[model samples]
Target: FLIDCFVFFQTFFSSQKKMSTTSTGSRLYESSKAVDEYIQMHYAPQDQLFPYDDQYAPSAGFQFVARTATLCVESFDKFGEIREGETLSALDVGCAVGGSSFELAKKFATVDGFDFSEAFVKTAKKMQLEKKLTYSSLQFGETFEDRVVSLPESLNTEGINFFWGDACSLSANENVSKKGYDVVHASNLLCRLPKPKQFLKDCGEWVVKPGGLLVLVSPYSWLEDYTAKEDWVMGLEGPFEALKAELSEKFELVDRKPFPFLIREHARKFQYGVSDATVWKKKCT
Candidate 1:
């Protein structure tokens, strides 16, 4: 029964990211099978935290699982932490697979996460409830290798809840509140939205509370498949300038830095890149 469940989860998760981009409901990473496979192989827990076994050696996947969160955490450290006595509340938008959300839960009293992909959201919910995940990775053309990932028991996960919703349409989500979160985070998600500008505009207006932290990180990998050329904030011209133009009215830029991460496709194959991150604090109105 467990094996059947794993097989079904694998197929469902894999197929979710394999659909056409023209669909209004399709998301960027959620519409790419390769990304789904990559997140499953890496972000899902392993038997051990660090220094994985031989088969999983070169566990560069940790960059996505922990390191991405580390970047956000470090940004907070350099900028600020939650208020001295107040409870922390955060929203992790575009929280693919929930790694960043889990990390945020370590600091916040409660962290709510949302993703456009139902498959990813379901897996994240299971990880929170069952504390374990079982899946297989593609070995070669027809070969597959099974693996099980266990969530760390020490992590305080009672405060994490994940849902399926559009980051671009957060105002419409009944579960999310406008200007309610102490920290609003979106890592590597800017370029993925169909209307990146609209997301930025909406975020500035209603998503983040006044005097809260708003962290935005992205590699600026704008693709026509995911976002239209006219809607891009980062085109051949550049990224940061236009991004500032969008958020400066409501958010003051505090820090701009580079966050490097790695994703492993197999033992021998990997992709490494640095994401441009900007830390913004919503102005007190």
Candidate 2:
């Protein structure tokens, strides 16, 4: 099961990059398969993520994105990071389908969601404008079931915005948020960048405000197609330890734990993973 999942993910990740201007690439992101996969991951219920009744089936891998998002706000409250009744702006980097972005909107004054896929941005914007989204879930190869996702009443969609941009180069997003944000989220994205170290630097330098939070959740599933070996953030040392060393100069580690995620491949198959989640408080310099 695990091997099949990894192979499927490698193929998916390899085709997910944005193409260069000079070259025309296949539009896989616009395909129904791509959209359906994200919808199920982001909007599907916990039971759907772990529907099996057998005790051996994977559990606690559901609601990965939304849970991590809530983790940021909850951590702030737990540590007294937020002032009394203070409002904050947030950025959701690699926000595929906008679940975490909307989750952030529950507490944040404003949230900006950025992704490399135009289809994801379009779908998220549709949900923003219409307050609902219709998608299909794969039951088997070429077989699907129709589903609709409604915007939760608890979320404030007015202050949320979605954009198509690259995590490695977010100048356009930086323009949208000139001052920086109180919280920056990039779940399962570090290993997907060609230059993960630069992304970490950018978070401290421009993406996150001083004395704010940078929430990262990643499995560190480094692949040559997505990231060069030399650019791996984990490096030769232990994964979290190396990441800790990388950000220690600019950020203070506040919390660390494991977050399990699940991706439904078909009705009977699912890809399960455990991501390391870390919350860092930017130094107020």
Candidate 3:
């Protein structure tokens, strides 16, 4: 059944690609915004920073996040041997509105979420507060209050934290260093930057501790021009190669998979697509 579903989705996505032109800069931005809005409306309901639905449905973004998070958690579990009472820390780079960060928080003892957008950080904080109040299982103790400043006073705690930070630059590393997360997660973030390989290398340096875990997912092949063909790299394979070349000295590839996904609520008729993901473990001396 799963194999059949994968095949059907591959065929559908291929057909959609043939019908559509490669989106350029503004067009790409617009398309991304549309997809983001659609996801926000359908999947994110805690805050309204993004103009979309807030219901918890199976949107494309949600599916992608779910698959990527599963890979990340599985890799971390296998490599780190995480157990209850262990002070496991996690960092979600480019966390957007905190959906993936919240997912991370559920798995680890401490979560530090960061995004370049102030609005995104604010929305993430609001959602974190709401999650604290509504969900008894999510226990964000004092760490949440000390790290996340924008959160409402009513639900301040310590288990989860949010901050404004950029992926391209590791200025956030200073903050991450303080928490010392055992796992670092980057979802579809590296490809969006101007220097994707460098971004990955920086993530390796800042987020993951020795013997920690690094999980990354990206649909775009390279970090060059979004619309132009100049010096462009192909999708997951190219980025994965570059990541390996850059991080091999300090990390070892542990697991890899392709996440089949589709842009839910798209007006266009595309059946399915996929994103490539990799899990690496920091070398332990």
Best by lDDT: 2
List TM-scores for all candidates, in order: 0.80, 0.85, 0.65
- lDDT tens digits, residues 1-285, model 1? 000001124445465644422233333344344334634544655433233566855444345546656655666666655667778788888776676788888877789988776656777788888777666555445455666766689988998888877776777898786547777888777877777787788778877777777888788877676678998896355788889988999999998877665554544455666778788988888
Instruction: State how far residue 170 of model 2 sits from its true place (Å).
Output: 2.3
**Against the unseen true structure, what C-alpha lDDT does each candidate score?**
0.67, 0.74, 0.54
Which segments of candidate 2 are over 4 A away from where they belong? Answer: 1-30, 54-57, 83-86, 172-175
Specify the highest-TM-score model's number.
2
Task: Give one digit per residue, the lDDT tens place, for model 3 in 99-141.
Answer: 6665666677678877655545665576766542221111122
Name the regions of candidate 3 deviating beyond 4 angstroms: 1-62, 81-86, 131-158, 172-174, 223-237, 265-271
Please give the range of 10 consecutive residues that has the lowest summed lDDT in model 2: 1-10
lDDT of candidate 2 over 1-285, digit per residue (tens): 001011123355445533211122223454445666677677777666566775856767867777988897897666525656657889888787888888889888889887777767788788888877787766766676788877776667998989877777765454458678888888888877777788788887878888889988888877676677888877566778889988999999989998988777677877778988899999988
lDDT of 3: 0.54
Candidate order, TM-score descending:
2, 1, 3
User: Comparing 2 and 3 by lDDT, which wins?
Assistant: 2
